[model samples]
Target: MDIIDNLNAVKRGKLSRRAFNRSLLAAGVGLFSAPLLPRKALAAEGDHPTFFTWGGFDIGELYQPYEAANGALPNFSIFGGTEEALTKMRGGFVVDAAHPCNVGLKRWVDSGLFQPVDTSRLANWGDVMPELVAMQGNDNGAGSPWMVPFDWGGTSITYRTDIFELEGEESWDMLWDERYAGRLGSLASGGDAWWCGAIKAGVDFKDIATDMAFEKIAAELRAQRPLIRVYTDDTTTLEQALASGEMAAAMTWNSSAVLLQSEEVPVKFAKPKEGQLTWVCGIMIHKDAPNLEKTYEMIDAMLSVETGKFMINDYGYGHSNLKAFDEFDEDTLKSLGLSKNPAAILDEGHFMIPQSQDWESRMNETFELVKAGF
Candidate 1:
């Protein structure tokens, strides 16, 4: 079990906090010092903040410090995408904190559902990668930070190396290969597949807002439809297909590669010549968080080096904390197809940028037509 689970045991009077903390140190959970808040000053035992985040993040490990201090885990809910989460909040689903990525930074801030975070309260704020923290529109020209980047990873092809062989330099073209027809997959969401399709179409990410770029991306994806066996947002389903040799390859993120390898599957995550699709996901406090102090503590816990290490080592993603890089050697990171420097991916890959919501609607509608063999 992770730290938060152990802390829950302590809260139930089944374990001691001191003993659990010692075990955490023994397991190398704390790479940077985060002094524990006095238990007496923490929120009341029954007062827990609510977190609205991605599916896999509603776990104990990410919020260990808060659970230990407050003696209860934060109430949690999961959203499949940031856009869906935003719509839910707009419809009156109140949460203390929500997870969004750099691509959604502008839209999330513009919604006015969130307030700027006081970095001073975040003990690990200084260690956050500036490239991630300074995403477009996040600085707001008023010295306030709008989002706190926590996790980052790449969107690229994961292929069965034992079954698939490239004829030339690795590129996104593999997804369009006729040889893999009826044996390949791609994400169903336009938010991801559209950008990746743009990369394959040779459209510069910066020009994605233009009509010419949209036409190019749409044409490329339409051409690619005959080759794809399925389209889904579920990475696990894709991973299972690749592992069972049912799929030769699929559009996937870094985690698929890590999870597949651990299960002893012969797979490789491509670093395509066209560039990988890189993204950064982070946390934002609701404008009217009912439990503001608990929410602040939860965000700080997520930014801690401990959580950063878990994110990188366990989930196969880059952490926002600089100290997390210190835990792994350059060789180790390279073996996992990651760079010790997040800038390598952010600067070199096809990092996503915010687009008008109307663009997203149009792209999704167009993609649906393509998927239906238009």
Candidate 2:
């Protein structure tokens, strides 16, 4: 899928806006987020195998050695949104499990779309980070773990410190500050922008269903559109924008900022006072997946500390494996925005999208309206 990776962001779909919202509504609607961990989940007896996840993740050279060590590559598919992934599963999309963020676990589990992961199968289970296990209850605790976390990262403000003087405690509010109107930047897509907006408005993203709250956030975004010069889903393009001085402030992934700064782009990723938006993406087995053992191998490959290091140092996402950060030198963790106390950062409200189709539709529509200056 060729996603927009430039300043002018555009989402391509065959369906019309009305149809898109209708499809989402029919699919159980709302954003994904971690809530009170469910005490129980359904179990499966090795039916489907293989995994699916976010684009450009858990693939490439990092896992090559793992494949050589484990044998065979796991079948994979990509999803635009967690809800979309869950929709397909509930609608009978096959596979044993799926990779979703911490925020979406509860809803996915509640949807009865997956079985608890038998952690005993994941040898790295004991070595995994507690912070990750906290949000995603293990297979043992929940009677079935909905998801196993792999990579984690913060949605932080990426700015060209050379050109922009970031004074005081930084936060998402700065992305909307009129002071930087035309110079300000953001991802035009619904997910990142919505999370940023939710945090700025002090609205908990996990529980965004009320119309009034939606409208308030709509107003906040509408107020921000004119100030936005470029809204691209491409993190690389966003980083280049800052690097080339085409734009000043940008909302970017932690890895992008770390990579940029390492190369001397004069960028700094600070967790804003209102808190930064965070996410964790992992492989999930579709309930009736065809490739079972291969899928488990893929998960095992990803859970390895060596793989975790590549994800953190090379990819820049905070690894859910607590041990991954330890693999890094002191300078590396700081450069990557890994706070000393990693658990505290995980405790920060992990942004989850609204699962309610009505609310989610409105959120997307709100973005559309704002982009259209509606």
Candidate 1 per-residue C-alpha lDDT over 244-312 given as tens digits, one digit per residue, 9 for 90 to 100: 788999998888787677556688999898889988888888998898888888888888888877777
TM-score of 2: 0.78
Q: Look at candidate 1 and tell me the lDDT of residue 212.
A: 98
Task: Give the Å shift of residue 35 in candidate 2.
Answer: 33
Distance from true location, Cα of 68 in model 2, Å: 2.4
Candidate 1 Cα lDDT to native: 0.81
Instruction: Please give, for residues 270-313, the per-residue lDDT of candidate 2 as tens digits.
Output: 67888888776665555555666666766777788787786776
How high is each candidate's TM-score? 0.87, 0.78
Worst 10 residues of 2 by lDDT: 31-40
> Could you tell me how far off, in angstroms, the CA of residue 224 lies in candidate 1 after the best superposition?
0.5
| Model 1 worst lDDT window (10 residues) | 30-39
Any idea what lDDT model 2 has? 0.65
On the 0 to 100 scale, the lDDT of residue 211 in model 2 is 73
